[model samples]
Target: MSRKILRATYAPQPQGQLTMSEHRAAVKAVCVFPAGVYWGQSYGPRIVSGSNDGSLLIWDPETGVTNRIGQHEDLVNSVCIMPGARDRAPRIVSANRYHSVRVWCERTEGDWEWELVGQHKHFVLSVCVLPAADGEAPRIVSGTWDNKVLVWIKQLDGVWKSELVGIHEEDVRSVCVLPAAGSEAPRIVSASNDKTVRAWREQTEGVWESELVGIHEEDVHSVCVLLAAGSEAPRIISASNDKTVRAWRERGDDGWESELVGQHENLVRSVCVLPGAGGEAPRIVSGHDDHTVRVWRERGEDGWESELAGQHEHWINGVCVLPGAGGGVPRIVSGSEDKTVRVWREEAEGGWETGLARKHEDVVLSVCVLPAVGDGAPWIVSGHGDHSVRVWRERSESGWESMLVGQHEDVVSSVCVLPAADGEVPRIVSGTWDNKVLVWIKQLDRVWKSELVGIHEEDVRSVCVLPAAGSEAPRIVSASDEGMVLVWRAQSEGVWKSEVAGEHASRVSSVCVLPAVGDGAPRIISASNDETVRAWRERGDDGWESELVGQHESWVRSVCVLPGAGGEAPRIVSGSLDKTVRVWCEEQRKGWEEQICLQLDSSVSSLASYEHYILIAQGNQTVRVWLPDEDPEGQHMLWIKVPASPCDAIWNIDPQAGKLRKPEIIVGTSRGLATFTIEELPF
Candidate 1:
């Protein structure tokens, strides 16, 4: 007989009644940061990330290993990968609050080499690389706190040379290169805190001329070139702190005229164009402090209109739209201060939707929707504060609702709904601050029942359900603040369990069961504040042997097993307080080969995995869903923002179909019960 492997599906399960203890524990709030900034490769599958920690880390999107390239020695302000580098390894240029510019290179041996390339007399605010000139070395343009634009060019001798190009009368905030149509001598565009967009074109030989394109009364922060095929001229897009995005077109001679493209509810931070699909019209993607990424496309006859794309709970920082594979639809990737990266793709009918949210957890996150599944609408489930589990459901063509589930007595931390059970009601299990595990079930009469299992001596942190053993009832495992794994076995014919696994040293934070490993019995994996994940197997005569499989630098909060891809070896996913998620695979020589899968700018609290994506819930009350293979540039993923207070802890996330008879997101919050439905917003 062939063994069957079960893959986890996400949906909302009904919530049972809440206990007073659960309510009391749901007090602190989870907070999310800005949502727009995203990481992408201009050359390869590597991601360039700049952090408040004052370092620029280059990450391999495939392996998630990071190499610190440029050390700002202070808060690194911004980073950009240069375009059009063929022979040279990808170059990363970063600006710092310390008024310096650093360049980093990935050597042939894969190690990162860094150097302080240039120094600004004043704090450096932003940096960007231009499309290189034919046979000439690439140039990097930077904006300074002193309100100046400095251009650095690589000399023939392999040394970098710098020159003070054009000076903004006030602080320069961002610099971008707009490659001239059919020409290699690209033009430079700069935005300033002084409220202006300045355009510069390379004149005769080496001299550059500048002109004020559009004078915004408010500070301009970001700018990019929007390119389209068959067009003699490319449009320039600029975003400002004034909450508007404007487009500038060349008006005859060298002068440029500007028109207001659209307005945002909050400050605009970044903008980029989706590379055109051969004959398809070009689209523009914009990120804003409003925590949204709005995609605008030409309507063939009409100029341009906005498509919802998606919205985040925090401010948006950066966006990069990339051409898809094998003539597929184009994709847009964005990153934000909310600490995530999101990918979006266009449908056959030109409709835009979310792809996956990469679980990066960097601030300035952004999301793009992917194509909806067969007859199924895509939905987002988020766990937040307010002591409630909230779900957001998408309805009709343009409607959505938030639903609230009241169950936990205090802050609901994490939520996971078991896969649809055979001849059984779908169930949701939540870990909470009240040190108790609550199971929610819907009765045949359509009413919900919330039952408290035995209370944990400490906070119940995370939970997972094991696939039922042959003829055996399913079991639920809970991790607790006391560093222990409690396994509960079904007592009655229902999904409820009555027994405990009873093993550990400190608080067990996360638990997962591996898929059947050949004739071997299923194994349970648990991560703890003890900085280790222990794998346990049932031995003959009912005894068990538990061995430590992996170790971490700090508290391990979440654990998951990688679904088998036609392979028999076991692989597991674990997240830690050290802000990294690691994938552990067994090695013949070494006990285990641990590879970092994703790095978060902040601590990672919970994680869930789908066939092709991984969703990460953070300490900041934000969730990031990542696609590991879609973009070599690591530019594919989506970021979903949840509204939680800064200090609020996110316990769990369970994606399940609700007993309310609709797709729902059941999230545990620190305050009160909340539900987000595809039909209506939960108040």
Candidate 2:
């Protein structure tokens, strides 16, 4: 039997590395680069990291075991440990760029459970925890440029109370909590773009006061409070755009002593302190814009010496010293803009070993499901950011077996599995960013062959298979970024021919062939970036007529042909970047009428029609199912919040999980493809 294999681009290019190939091939490099990293006090010495790909990961440095704790809505900005009771599972709070803070804890099923506990008005930059006292519940402090410094207090009744600490006028870059000393409450220190490090203290009941401790010339990007080592009082270390790490000591009553501790080649972005070997002095580590993390060591009356602790190809965003097991030598963890997180553990002779991280090599651009045969389960075929397509066959109940089906010189963007006839193996088609369309044919003798067919002038964005007609050879439709839609028909088992169906004023994003009526010529519908949906009809062989069928307020991104109820003139549903899903129904001899319009929370990235319902993949991690009704308000739409990453591609999959087989929806995100079945798809 025949199968299609594809492997090309999988994710974005690494920041410090030129290509995904270079980054993954580097043996010493561990690939996991979550935007934020922290060590949980109760967990088993595992390092918790928040990734831009919307995952919270736990890394076991000693054993090289990486566990995905949970996921975030968007790019995760900060992660802080939440103090739980001794018997309760460890809880962690993570802040994402999507303006939300979420809390996660371990579930009984060995996975994780999380809830959206709070939201900010703008991008949340930093988060820190206030250690709980004897009678008071714990509290969390977070800061951002958009709104006030929010203090979320966990009350005894289990409801979270948010208090706004309005002080910083500009962007709050970092926040650190100084534990309450004696009778004073815990102090919140924040570094900001307003050029100063300010401390907020609650003097009276529920009232807070701000005090400026030190000022920097440029934006202060990071702040950390060094644990007082007896003789030396509490000191605040700040990193900034000025390329320096300075320490501010508390002088007599609110007075401050400024000392430049170390210098970096570029602006310093993050700072952390590691315990010295055998309880000696501490080592201060700072990450810089020069793509280096420097370690500083002081020699009493002599000058301080700095060594390059870690190196990357891009600017570093976060750095933390994962407290070692049983107070051993600490390991340094650094996250970089290069899409990599490197772990450095102090080895023999003051050297560090940088090595245990792997992220998705590249983004998956499109996915399609191949149905299971009599004895097998369904297989998921995917096109990636690179020039490759992969087939993931369900091996067991939840396990998958992956096969690289095909490859292109550039990014592969789309994949479609064609229905097979009788005992014939399946055939698949793929589109790429390199303006090439390829069809893979599975022979009866069990060999898979791929041949490049239609060639466009620009990147191919979408592809679909035309349902087979009696005499029509197997045909495939492909849309390109250059506004042209090409129809390809197999000339033979080894060759294919293409013809332009029609054109859009702007780049075409999606194309679908309407259901065939008896033996009539197939009607084609396409959604364009120009905010219009156009329909094409093939008159004879070379004659193709086109007309504007529908238009949206913004760029149209997705479209699907919806069969009318009771054999009515078929209708079309279109979704666009304007955050609206519109249905266009045929109006007798007149043009298509805009029937139903439903506003969504974000841009509709993809859409699929199942039975009588339409599924929409929203740009912001949401999938909504719209059911047809006489109500114009579209109140019957059922929606589900897709977990974590942006849903870029979606499809309806037939699952063989049990005897009662039903259609389930699978969504593709930057993290991976997830299958979530809707029990109540109102058809």
Candidate 3:
């Protein structure tokens, strides 16, 4: 028998009840095919580089193996490692010639992936990760050709937000953060095309003030900071297009004085400080248009002396000092127009060895399932609060394995599997708090890829896929916190068009596609904070229209549809904050009306229906299975308490695919995923 292979790219985590701190230990470096390198930074024993080819590579210095792990739309211009919270993996910041600046975090149980964080009105020229103190939140500084500098801080909720910190008279070329001094606020320095270097001090919380540090005869191209040691104060270093590099120090009179560091034969394009090792004097490494990297050592009273460390085949654009571990000699990595990143390291005998620097949810917000192919087991896909989407499947020999499949800029709020007939490739749709909906489809090559399909005015609360009607292609329906619902139809592969389908009096909380009764037009079901459950169908000339079918005293938080069995009409199932689950059915003469109402002790968080069973997830840590038509009076079938508050739930095909297999219900709690079997429930 032939089996389908599902290939996906993105972030992921496993199913279990892992504490917040325990989750941090789950991250591991993954291997991939190698790619070229461009902008680079050294993290621990590994080197991470962003490429002009729009890929991010991680290089193992010992094995000389490079792996491509991430990608961008444009050439990566700058890359820096952000100091993470104490005991956490440091995050990476990268910029491209485009307005995009992305923050890549090593995801727990997954690869190092990026989420786009900030954008400028013009190209982002430089990015600097701020020096974060223990327990301090991570922050970043970016310089843009828009003549502005932005400061991004990771907020308490784990979102990175940007604020305008300063504006230059001309294009800001480079930015650097000064080492933290005692309890002082962060200090940022920037070099600009206006031929001036400026320093910004956070005089007040979130407010900045700038002062002129120094000026050059030509545009300043790069800047770096030397941390203060003993009696020596921290100093600012700037390189200019005028073939000069200057070191500036704050004078006792609050003025700044610049010392001539070095004069180059060509423009000094990049500069970085290499700290002294074993009581050695600190040195500065500068890359120049003269096609050489020069190392300048401060010779006490004799001034600074420079020597050519390495030469590139073309003009150099950026350089970074890779501090060796265990007192190993520091290495200089430079990116040049030569399309190479060369690493210059000091040999044991003292001469330099130049070589090609090898590269390099807390919530399961949503849960879905891909039916087993041939002899294979079904696959479970989930979205989490950590901004990742993961696909999990079981193997006969290895048990289960998972791959990170998608990532969003914010919390993923909902996920749905598109309607697919047996033997057809299944597709997944996800909605996120970032106000966007993305579609993941398995390609002809069997690789699963995602494309942004639509955007909402506010947080996307829920998403569902409408099956094709006659000749129409399947559509994506999404509900948002702003009370609007949108239906998206594919215009072409990887392209989509959307139209407003309906609106609610308040936030539309959940949406689900209803199975067609016969050859009738497809229908959609939606629940909202407006305290109502609504059904919508296309009316030809009237477009799409909605009719109120069910109501509760409080916000309707979740909705699902039960396909008709026997000769019965389909039923709309809704769960509400009023602690009730209501079932609606269409009558012969009357419109849709409530047929069953089951009261519970706590508010309902989510709802999922399959066959004759309705899974009701509650924030009180309980998942109650209700069989509405089981007996004369609807009765509870099973009650399973979870480890944490339930956020969402879904009924999926048994992943185990046993001899006597049965469908299962997967619950997404605040922490992770939990699955339950109900095959043996007494009738």
Candidate 4:
């Protein structure tokens, strides 16, 4: 028998930190949303997601890309594709705020053409296409905010027509059709905000009739139907705002009986059934409002005992299986109220083991891993509430060692290492809650040289190292709680000279340097609690003048510069507490055109970008990586999970250093530090 273990990157929270006062309590709590929702194939090459942004996207499980589709006008609420249909092209349908469902055909020439389908009387919220039956034309069932279920059938002339099949007192939220069981006609199940599930069955003569399955006592938000193997009866699972999932089965004599799958602690929102694979028992996946999704499977032969398969943080909004993608293992994809979509696959071994565990004095705010240089092992540097900085090193294959501790006197808010300066050993710089900045350098031995402090008068919030400018030594810039930006340049062998100070109306939250452009003056960009980003350049005369780059509806938490593509001006990317990542490109004449690159339904805590990928870390302990060109219109690039109880600050992804030779992500948590390597992740 194989052992099942959890392998997570864990860090221990620091001990002995001054507790935050009552007034600071409200300021410390954080809320996060899902990075983005994805929809795609159930197998190998899937369609990860399409959006209201008006674009369709295709995805390859091995590599992920963003902007996979082009654009849309309103919020895209739903998508569906007809499988194994005629014309060798899948019929795709999408719903939006306009109460319209548009259909598109994939042409043999590999292009997509869109056509307006029938319009709903109100906001079309969801849509699902049913499998064709008895050589009959395929059908589409859609639920609308108008509280009605609309069924569309293809006419003998090859055109489609719609009719109202059932009505509820409140909004109809979802609809799904059950596969045929035995000789019975297929059935359709609909969930509504009125707190009930309605089953519509095809009669002997092919006419549809509705019956109420009085299972849920609150708004029934989602419903799915499952057919058990070797069993003639089909099961109906419904999720409701009442915080429970109920499974109902139709008996041979025409009566329905239900049971509770009491796992979720909040409103159950979505449910999906996983068909048996390789003779294994079938399983059920459900999403809830309490920010969790529970997977349940039958335990024994009698099917009387049910056990949890797994759980995910955040309200699970949707779940589906990739038909042929997981090497016959069957994969499950889930969406959540947290604004993220996660893909889970069972390991060949029973399960994964949890990673490392550590602690912090205050919330371990920000974490970064220094790039590994030839033969040098990577190191994780963390800043915490105790106003201190600590360094953790991965010493061996399975061991982590603490190398340095206590570098600040107040909560250390940020940490970053400067790029190496001409053979000079790189130095570590930190910003603290005490409004001071500290720089550390290696001495004759491995001991840290005397810490240089007092660079700022207010709490230091963030720190960044600007790339080299001309022949000038690289400079370290720090953002502070006092809404100031302070620049320090290396003065002597080990000391830094404060060269400039600039101000804003609110606390500076994040800072980065724009990549140089053809002799252009190096510019420093900073995002603030003021909801604006300001760009500053060192004037040839030595004074700093500031220009407003753009504005966000909420606080901008992190900013990164995507390396230039083909000599194009480097794009500046920012993540905001407003639940969006905006990309700004400079126009030769217009200052900056802010393009809403991605709208993460959640607050984005941190962001990192390489030449090929952009990574966003959220408050939910998850990271999203996106490749720019695969699909221009899709929302998700790829979703990656972090260790438990994650921080609300910037984390680092060191794609270059790791035992597996693939990019490794280093995360700082409230407890300790952990590393996520590509080899450990399902590609």
Q: What TM-score against the true fold does each predicted structure earn?
A: 0.47, 0.58, 0.48, 0.48
Per-candidate clash tally:
121, 25, 5, 71
2 against 4, candidate with superior TM-score: 2
Stretches of candidate 1 off by over 4 Å are 1-46, 55-71, 83-86, 108-110, 156-158, 182-184, 204-206, 349-353, 357-683
When summed lDDT is taken over every stretch of 10 residues in candidate 4, the lowest stretch is 22-31
- Per-residue lDDT of 1-683 in model 1, one digit per residue for the tens? 22121221223323321111111211111111111212322333444666554645444332223333433556667777754355454566778778788876654222345677778888887888776656766788888888888788877776778877788889887888877666446788899887889888777655778988887768997888876467557778998988888989888786788777778788888888876676767777888787788887776556678877766546766676545545656566666665444455677786666553322211111111111234544333334323454444655564445455454565455565554444464566667767777766656764557776557787676767777778775667787877767777667644455444656777787787887767878878899878888887777567567877888887787777766566657578887867777778767577666754566665665665655445566554455555544531224444444443112222222233311233233333322222333332111
lDDT of 2 at 667: 65
**C-alpha lDDT of all candidate models, in order:** 0.61, 0.71, 0.74, 0.64
- CA lDDT for candidate 4: 0.64
lDDT of 1: 0.61
lDDT by residue (tens digit), candidate 4, 378-470: 567787654567777665675666656456655677888877754566667888766777777766687776466456767688898877766
Q: Which candidate leads the pack in TM-score? A: 2
CA deviation > 4 Å runs, candidate 4: 1-7, 11-362, 371-374, 420-422, 493-495, 631-634, 643-645, 648-661, 679-683
Query: All predictions: root-mean-square deviation over Cα?
Result: 16.0, 10.9, 12.8, 13.8
